[model samples]
Target: MSLRIEQVGPASSARLAAIHATGFDRPWPANEIASLLHMPASLALAAYDGDEMGGFVLVRSAVDEAEILTIAVHPDLRRSGAGRALLDAMADVLVRTGVTRVFLEVSTANTAARALYDRAGFRQIGQRHGYYADGTDALVLEKTLQGSGQDGA
Candidate 1:
């Protein structure tokens, strides 16, 4: 089945945490996700097939800007268009909410994610040294939304 994107709340925190644990060594706990979901600016979107989760993307907005807090696809679902779908879905939300610019940080070692963002029109503007616990640098990418995103899937 194809993945479907849906807005989620604090109730989905445990499930999100499970998926997050698969992607990150220092994954946020369920309580942390729950607390973020309770914030006024936070938005969470889950990609699911029927009731099974494929991935999730979480972001927070302030004024005309937004930042992607996290985005992950199940290991089994990688390269299945899940990440692009979530990104496109998020762009729609940000556009509707009048967000003009979106930003995200991805580890320089995460080539797949960097490629994805490149395809989506995010350009690297700077770098954060030793941003990850493993001493990996992070690429700070930003995309200026002009009514839509490039390669929105």
Candidate 2:
């Protein structure tokens, strides 16, 4: 499939929310997504297959550090490289803005996501107990940027 990743704005909140809802059990509302997108520190990227949104990644950066707030891919489109592309696009944007590291939390039970992060060079740095709505532990992972030649970019 041909997937194009692009920086998105508040106007794309509904589409992001829709795609997010399809991937997660409890999705953020469009207004919440819009509000986050409107924040000065917030950045979002969306992956589109032509006119349809396939996935997205949202982040908040502060100084040289950034945290991935959320990442989601359409249920029917998982494992198709859209997630990796979104991450790569996000890293490209982050590097341009002087970000040196990116961090995110994934559920301990999500082996697929954990594997994806591992393959992307993220290392486990910590963990949070009962961090999810379902009382699952969250594994905190971090990836240190390596110049502008990294895979994600």
C-alpha displacement of 77 in model 2, angstroms?
2.0
Clashes in each model (backbone N, CA, C under 3 Å)? 0, 1
Model 1 alpha-carbon drift over 4 Å, by segment: 149-153
Give all candidate RMSDs, comma-separated.
Answer: 2.0, 1.9
lDDT of 1 at 108: 99
**Model 2 segments more than 4 A misplaced:** 149-153
Please, what are the lDDT tens digits per residue for candidate 1 over residues 28-110? Answer: 99999999999999999999987899799999999999999999888988898889899989988988898888999999999
lDDT of 1 at 106: 98
Give, for candidate 1, the lowest lDDT window spanning 10 residues.
144-153
